[model samples]
Target chain A: MQHMTIRKSLIWLGGLMILAFLLYTLLDVSGTDLTPQDRINTFSTRFLGIFIEAVPFLLLGSLVSGLIEVYVSKDDLLKLLPKNPILATAGGAVMGFAFPVCECGVVPVTRRLFTKGLPMSVGIAFLLAAPVMNPIVFVSTFIAFGWGEIIVLRFVMTIVVAVSVGLIFAYLARPHETLLPVSFAPVRGGNWGIQPLPPQKMTLIGGLYRAGRIASDEFFEMGRFLIIGSLLAAWMQTRISQQSLLDIGSGAFVSVLVMQGLAFLLSLCSTVDSFVALSFLNTFSTGSLVAFLTFGPMVDIKSAMMFAGVFKKKVVVYLIVLPFLMTLLIGIWVNIWMMR
Target chain B: MNITKIPAKDAIKIMILFGMSGYLAYTILSENLGNYINNSRFVWLTWVAVGLFFVLGVVNVLPFLRPKADATVLLIETSSIMPKSWIVMFICALPLLLGVLIPSQPLDVKSLTGTLSTTVSVSNTTVITRDPLKRNILDWLRAFSLEADKTAFDGTQAQFSGFIYRNPEFPDGVFMVGRFVVACCTADADPIGLPVYAPQADDLAEGQWVEVRGTFLAGEFRRAITPILQVEMIEPIEQPKNSYLYP
Candidate 1:
């Protein structure tokens, strides 16, 4: 009961912060002497700026996802998972290195894995960890921050949050209890080695052709979120005074929540989000910035909706709440310990 | 019939993707993409997007080329190409539309977020002493803060270019020459400035790009003791190909 109350209040608090930000943004844009024409022009350029920087990565992500969809067989992957539930779950988190789908691609990929009889906790861990665990993101973050403390902080926090959340579901929830019928039907087989689906076979060129076809569709699917999310970030920058936003970000606790909030709201691809986070380096606390890097990739506007599609509604709540609280606590602790 | 058989929604999506690709290509070829983003990484990335977009559109059309395929194949293809809402199609078309309609302009003298950043501790520090004449406003600004004594800048010849913005309270010969330093994109640009003491400054207009070559003296700017660039030669010039300086 106590846990439920605290969770409820946090949710309410998050909602209020978003609302307050929106209200403040509206007021600031109105007060500026910018004619509607200037406003629209400025917003349009900013939106295009962010969109241009990210679209290439989104294209690459979709292509990689599409190729994986056609070439990588889930039956083979099922055999690779560990026998013990705990080991399997941890392996799932690290397996993101092999199958590096971003927040958007991870969803359909996770869903397909679920249907191939992946262990529930493993599937859950892969879903959260795969976005940031891949090589593309590693290279991008390295380019943005170099081999520095930020990269270490980002990856460390992601693994910790992802593994802990997966273990919670492993200990507390049954596969059938949390997954919807569409996903649960496969899990009903109930073992690491269950192989109900038929094995696939395809020629090299045939797989390439199919991969191209799938990549195109995935591009369209993921591209929608990218376009809309860029629009929101651009619009927010136009409306809110960047200095005032930085001023609010000066506090350790508030900055973490604020960065986390922006992370959720922006819904950028993990491959490119480090560049976005790099801009806030001077003002935001270290922990909050890590929270932005970790939590944004794990659970955000697009990924949350995708999670809803794959899991039961009750489980979706748990998926978001667990990562949110864990990362927030870790972020705050980092700020206090690392800053001084 | 084969073209009409293509789902209307799919057709529009293909066109939208291709149109965006063309718009991106146009920006790159015409040198306008730099107005919106730093092109050091994106020049190649944008070309990749061009190829990917073209490939995506071509692949979508490839199925229509085989009009007389097996019935089961047709059924399977149609299933994945389910008709999407017109609203989503509109949203996807937005970037291309905006790119064409809006005149692409960099953030100019008017958009300074706060007073010009006086003391910035940049994480990526470059040695500012390479060539005093070649130093941009940002490099010089860093040098100003790091110097122990304010008068150390005296007798040092400097030359730099930036758009102009001024304070009304400034003396007749003084104005702020400012540059917007961009790391990733326009969204995070922070404006930095240097005070130029030029008797010819009143003739120059705001947002006008100029090159000032002169020696610096310790002087008051923004009510603080900072290096003031006294102009020996102030020449009006066209905006550089890359307007914003990358750190």
Candidate 2:
């Protein structure tokens, strides 16, 4: 498996170049008569914007995960989380307060914890809940919505959707069944797993050094997925006119879908999304906005792409599909019945 | 296996990470960072980027200095997390190339698709008390959303700068001072503009940065009586380093 040679590096570069070329053609065919210079400049500005804004959080997540890997003993982590699957998954729903990681940061952190034998339900719940369930986002939403239904509904709905989805995974999935083998760290519940490496004898200073090393390596490991995801999102934003997409679907059911679609497409940070949702107050129903607030933080283009790196492709699909369907039902219910 | 023959993935990792730091620092230093993100909102984050990338770069170097037998086990474990490819390794390094090669331009007419929202409010109550003269395009829209009578904004001293834009819907000799409003990043930026009835707008080219010192009055704009800026003084200005208004 460790057969990578210097000659193989060229292939990666070649793959990226092909991607860039394909992106250029997509724009060209999308009906813009663009000078190549204009296309590259506009797309690059957007691509870098998302990358730069999110990378800080990504690094912070990597750093924390590295710290957790070194500082928190595996036994401590296991003890902290409940062994009862339902209780653990339920606890995971509101566990965002401790981590406070955003959608961009949560994936890597969850993946790291999974390696430490974090339960499937906890990881799944935290993955979905962390973005919306955290304090920063809560405060932001509060400021936007005030002490009212929108704010309370957003949180409750997020927890409901996240926990429901988490329990679904916990009931159905084994750790190995959904996780990448390398991420299956000493997880006993799995059919097979990697035996823990002998603990390194270390001083406090040594631990810090080891943490730094793990974080940097992880930065490279997960960082690539972020870049590619940002690329696709930026490209899509440049070509698709968001206003046109939003102008459609004013009905109770359809507006929820449209708003959810907008959330996925825009991929705005969950903190600022309430303000964006505030703009739709006059046009969209309460439920759709709820869906947007809940679904957006749970699944968006960039975060969805990042999820692919840690979980199996099928698990990633469930990660999206479950949250989407549940949020949609809740949102539609709010529109059709609650608001009425 | 010859240890020296294999290009140390560790060394490549260091270079790529350090390169990320260098690129990020370059953006911050070059003042072109504003073209990509709202610098005012994310200034601290850019510093975090510089520091983290630099720290990570240093961390990668340490593995070589003290290569213990147990470190090989780490090597194998870490290797499994990423796809086995030199290309995949380069993907993290992709931004360095894109940032250096592409000249980051602030969004303007080229990016403004469809009609810009003149009356669309973003619900920022904080700026409702701020002086209208100090308000940007977004603040003005938010202010407008609070008032039922459109004429409440009339005769208010309006002073702000944005790129010039006009659509087919715009009245003749009228152009809008458009600002790209970003909640997070350029990906979510949407063009918002206020109409300005100025004969001089005919001479001003699209996407040209200009400062408008005028008074808002209810006038015919986009086929509606909205708070149209009756331009008193308009001057061509260089594009600001960070042109986006943070919502």
Candidate 3:
């Protein structure tokens, strides 16, 4: 059949491409000087660094998602969510305190929740807030900035931004428009949306087996975006100078925009970004630093790519743009009121 | 020979996942984890991830080898493995391949060129300790970032170690001795150093790690009023086991 021929050709082509890449890598590695000065070396190292750092969190998220798929009933999840949309959004914003996941891990968990019939508004809030509003990031930020207004303000602004975004989704978008395709949805009364195993098949060994399969599936599905995202981030870090970007912007407004732009490009994990931001404390204004902290975990290159996997294209665009505008405005206002 | 039929795609996924997890565990066990991640705390997480991947991989692949297992159930379970999933799996495997194939090295002097800037103003509030010789390059850089007047550091003895960085704009006898201060990972590393004035500075090759024992003298270097190290001694040294300074 033509289909079989094409498939065979594609497999052969993929194998050959991988072989070529391996040979190239080996040649590069075997060279006498293998310092990170070379663009190829630097890019590869940083790319692997980001990927390696994120994998553990991603795996944890998948396991949790697997548990959700097996044990947490759809009706029970819905029952836990508040009836009022506003209350539900607030609940979502604060929910991350109890469930602390990094930006890399939050996407798959959000997708799992969404497929289990979680309200879009609440899911959106959790997705954005869970990265920064968690306890780990909170303590990290506190340690980095010390007992300062910046730390307190970061928390306040994060909750505000998350809740507002959630409210917007709740009031503006329809349920179907916000979610992924129906086939990708998690079916009720089944482990991972496959055919429900009989009561006899629902033993402990059977459940563990099902959870492992679901976790593996979810890891591969979400991991592609993480790889591509990290690749872009690494490329930008090597090619673009942070100083050049910082040099152009000086005033409160421009500085906020510049720092926010840097945050998006860097796509650093929330737990560690504060220390990096601290190095800039002397160079950048207070408000710009706040913007960097608030906007980064909410939307970054990596998170944006992950968003594309779960939400509609239009929804993804809003998720990126709205956060930029919100963070920029808040940063400028804070600059005028506090920095002065 | 009642072997259960497993989708070929699921088998491939298991192999890729298992391979990546194994590679991660190897990196940690080999103590090459610092080449990628700056934090030692992440080693335990990597171990846990390896266990998860191995468990999941074995579970997914076991059905195909078992005799008299229901083929119908296996087929239904493996139906989720789509043809497009191969692309995702390939991407996931890429970093692992790169880690193994490519030689690991720390960022070099070239990375410093783009990030270093001359106009960074120091605050006056930095508390300079009485014994200035005890500070590292980062400590000196921090003191430099805070010092309002460069002249205050004059005659202060200092000893520090870092790679040599030469700005083309500097005079023949001047070069910056710089080290990258990494807050989390290499991506966030920022180069910070002090300019040293040595009569034999031209003899030093860039990117070579060296220790400079010198006294801080107030002077203008490269058109900026900054504290310059009057180098009394300079010697080449092996790159430290942990090349990057953690904040």
Q: Judged by TM-score, which candidate is best?
A: 2
How well is each residue in A189-275 modelled by candidate 2, as lDDT tens digits? 531212233467666876776677677766766788888778887777777787787788778889989999989977777767887
Error of 1 at A305 (Å): 6.7
Off by over 4 Å in 1: A1-33, A100-120, A139-148, A169-202, A249-251, A258-285, A299-322, B1-4, B69-78, B81-83, B110-115, B145-151, B167-175, B197-199, B203-205, B218-225
| Winner of 1 and 3 under TM-score | 3
Model 2, position B230: C-alpha lDDT score: 89
Per-model CA lDDT versus the true structure = 0.75, 0.79, 0.78
Model 1 chain A weakest lDDT span, ten residues long: A190-199
> Which order, best to worst by lDDT?
2, 3, 1
Residues B110-178, model 3: lDDT tens digits? 554263444332333446563677787777766776767889889989998889987678787888888
Error of 2 at B61 (Å): 1.1
**What TM-score fits each model?**
0.81, 0.89, 0.88
Candidate number achieving the greatest DockQ relative to the actual structure: 2
At residue A141, candidate 1 shows an lDDT of 92
Q: What is the lDDT of residue A16 in candidate 3?
A: 86
Please report how far candidate 2 places residue B146 from its true position, in Å: 2.0
From the highest DockQ down, the ranking of the candidates is: 2, 3, 1
Clashing pairs in 3: B122-B145, B123-B146
lDDT of 1 at B21: 78
